[model samples]
Target: MASLSLPQVDFRAAAAEGAADARLREAVRNNTLRKQEGREARWTELPDAQALRELAARIKQHTLENLDYYLRQLVDAVRRNGGVVHFAADAEQARQIVLEIAQQTGCRRIIKSKSMATEEIELTPHLERAGLDVVETDLGEFIIQVSHDRPSHLVAPIIHKDRRSIARVFSEYFHAPYNDDPPALTQQARLFLRDKFRRSEMGITGGNFLVAQTGQVCVVENEGNARQSLTTPRVLVSLVGIEKLVPRMSDLAVMVKLLARSSTGQIMTVYTNIFGSPRQNGERDGPQEFHLILLDNGRSQILGDPEYREVLRCIRCGACLNVCPVFRSIGGHAYNSVYPGPIGALLSPLMFGLERYKDLPQATSLCGACGEACPVKIDIPRLLISLRRDMVNRRLSGKLERLIYRLWAWGLQSRFLYRVIGALQRWDLRRRADADGWIARLPKLAAGWTAQRDMPAAARRSFHNIWKDRH
Candidate 1:
């Protein structure tokens, strides 16, 4: 593996190019099975998976319904535990709040765990621009950060690349000869980041679930980067989306059980820690200061909307990405947002508005792979159809498409005209047929269709036409 310097545009372009055709479908088909089989084996090995999912679903529903009460309870609990609480209406406010804390503490270099909420706010860019050094401690995130790249996968940011690529990125960032082997690559990153961990001024992380019952923050990860990040510094900040709040500490068991099986197919992640407030006096090692910023950008909007409220049930599991045909091909960047799969598609529109994401909704084949793959089972396809309908009703669709659909409706309304048109189309195809039973290509608007596909040579007799004749 050579040093793969990941330029953002190039990375996004490669992903966008791959998703245009069959190769995108093939890529997802391959990875999806690996993840699905792994999950099935893990779940089958433990009889607790289905029960956990049902329990987790109920817990999420309960929290969502009484979110106001639970969020207030979570805040009080955190305060009781001596953790400061910050409310951010959107990303900028969240970033500003974090930066203000860092400045107030006179902190410069900060270490962080993998947190999608932090990613949603893009904490690194904000902190770096403010003259602070922020290092990602998670192995996958470390690979991406060192390469200066955006994460392609939610769980495994480097899933699109192999060990060879990992070695290359490490070699370049660490300025040492790195091996392409897995163990060697892992060792190099471990050694290089260890020093950063021990010298950090502050640490930041995202919470998996915030227990309202005990005002505890929970995180699950294969690597101990999150643990290190949360414990290494004087000021520890945990950024959690408002939707991550769960009503009770007991509910944590159910969600955690479902998390691993639905995600990487493990009975449990290698590390699961519940932190209650900052470390107390005589504690061996932990942060001296703690803060939890609960962000509610567009989440509150979803809560108010009847049609899109279920979007909150997302547990940040990447199952939808593995089973998504569109995501596999284009990866996440093509949507031009943080989220890049079925979940991303839904969130991007809501967060950024659908008008800006013109190509996203139409990118799907209307297949229900995403919904089927989801652990909580979000109805993605139905939402997509609803968005399309909304787009059309808003007159956001192209005029030509509206005309075509109207003409199609009118033609189909009269059986006599429909048969006459079908008969003419078949006659035209017969007249144009040449040697080899092929017409090579068709004309104008129809040419694009036949360019990659031979539009079923207008069967000598149409299905409806033949049915009538036989009767």
Candidate 2:
């Protein structure tokens, strides 16, 4: 088994660094805003977008409620179709299972599609350590692989990167003249990967949804890389989270309707591959051996808790990330988790613990954009608030922070203290104002406010004072 231990995450530092990068901020903001606009445009084409989202949420909720039963059914169905199913208790177990399969099948070369689940388990390095040649076939993933960079977005892996950066990477890798053309870069990669695909003996993928009724793994993609990953190799392995189950194929219809629209604003992805089992007697293509590894990895603990279980309904479409004010300011890597943005804020704390990822919940502005943007309606802001309350209950908050909040609460409950605090706050703010009336700096606790934007000085007269004078 490979080591899964991770060092302490400094989310605040990473977020601050990302926020300070003007070029990175511009790239991420422009891409996400365009996707958001496309989503809104696509939503208008639907008869009842909200109703469809509700239906999709209900389907996921139903599957989660009866997960055990669905799991049994899914396993049996896969077996009936000549496919194998394996249960992994965590990331270590999941990696071990794939390694064992690789060893048994005598596979040396592997091709992998873009799967966040595989990334979540950190499978690639373990395989590389085992001396197997593994290549990321997805164009974005390929860039990330060669450049030694992590994905910054769910759908668009290299959202933080510009054409210049990519061209530099490609030029260095291919040892060719600098070319920033999109088609040329894509051709350079495609020509390089075409040979790898031909030689790869095994394929790896992540599922968007698992249809329990027919034991099919449905993977959606704009590019055809996932299709090749499924059909080009003799042995196929799919690593999917346990929470990805959908009870019926009809339910998959409801999910598919919202998935692409919510993700990149397409009516449907260019390729939506739904497959089960290995190739049958007359099949010329497709894998001869298939294995599905269902990963738990702290999900069972999350499922057992009612307050946070609804988050399991997420389809990972990343609509929330696109519309997130905080994510727009600071890209995905700042979250310091395989998942990022509003969803990552909830998941990291819930799956890992509040102690390691306490700053994640505070990353959001609680603007409710994530909740409204979610296709599955996960209510991310509500979950974030719940996590914050949990943090306070667990004494994860600092002593001074708790004291300040307590004092603030106490002052709010008393009229005299409220007025006194308000007067003092106004005076202090006014005193800090520069000649132009913009406060460029703030005192201790509120200093971060002026770090990016200047604050305006409070008005000399209050509304209450004006009303009293008029009366």
Candidate 3:
């Protein structure tokens, strides 16, 4: 019943705002730390966790390399299984395709499962403008819709919201007494959404994995809302990115084993829906019409570049988010895309232009936590560095920033200049130190470094000087 449109994202501004919010930071820190711990515990249950991650990565890479062949095979298979396939070159086309389907079906009441693809295209607002009543069925998504707020995390959408804020939102939305209890909030949403599920004429979802061998769209979720989206409507549509394809059912099996564990540390989600075709003659109930929209907004560009194609291996498990220090502190809203965290830092720039999301590449600390936590073993930090390099090469970085780096390079080229600059920097920094020998503030370009953290005063003697004295 409600929708959200993301405004122009200023990563620096948003990151500062999120960092300044103690409550938001605490909420994100607690949730992500818990999930990170859970993921570590779950991975230990495996005989060879790293090996499995490598195998999964290989499967994805192989599929991406031969994506055309698998996609063709998938299209043929889906057609044979009584499913229609649509290709969208971009976001506008994707929205238009779904609108056409709704128009053709003469459908009005629509219920959507939690879908990042849908969020990426801002589908709900488009559908609403077409005079359709669309409801978000997933609990977190439902809350997001009700509050007109964007999701801050892939798996845990409301990680930025604490119980008290959620209680106020629920109270205001339902016009009922405040209740912060998790079960009560869930029950409240369930009761409201059940009616929408029963009466919906069309259902929309996003595919977690599209199995090329069997033409089945695999969707795993902790809640049964996705299950309801599949069964309750006369028409069902799954809008998925083209990169979601896995070569075979066996590959899908391997992915399933890691997805839930990486996301929430569960061995398996409560619902795992694998459906492609419309209901058969003998079937009691299922969608009468099925449509799969393959979206390629910017994936083809990333896939074509061998240097960064590994970024596509991301499965949206939110494992990287849980382990990323920047995301844990500043939260997902700072990334300014439907995708967030370490993966988003790489993706938002690649999918969107480098200039549009230039700041995203600089968001990471390059701590390698995301890379280690990634279930598919995607080299996240490497790819982020790649994106950062691209930003510089493409002249997306500020002129002053580029000039500063050039000067730094020039200084480093000569030993004398390097020593001179190092000594001057140390002397200046030490001069700025307070009585406690901590530099609490800095001027100009170095101001941001001291904004949130104090720099330790430099030693009186340089390492070179100390070495000369010893000699």
lDDT of 3 at 25: 94
Candidate 2 runs further than 4 Å off: 1-6, 431-438, 469-471
lDDT of 3 by residue, 196-238 (tens): 9999999999999999988889999878989999998999999
C-alpha lDDT values of all predictions: 0.80, 0.91, 0.90
Error of 1 at 57 (Å): 2.9
Q: Where does candidate 1 stray beyond 4 Å?
A: 1-16, 20-31, 45-54, 428-448
lDDT score, residue 238, model 3? 99
- The local lDDT score (0 to 100) that residue 368 gets in candidate 2 is 98
Q: Which ten residues in a row have the lowest lDDT in candidate 2?
A: 1-10
| Backbone clash pairs in model 1 (N, Cα, C under 3 Å; residues 3+ apart or in different chains), count | 0
Q: Estimate each model's TM-score.
A: 0.90, 0.96, 0.96
Over 160-179, each residue of candidate 2 has an lDDT whose tens digit, in order, gives 99999999999999999999
What total of clashing residue pairs does each candidate reach? 0, 0, 0
CA error at residue 338 for candidate 3, angstroms: 0.8
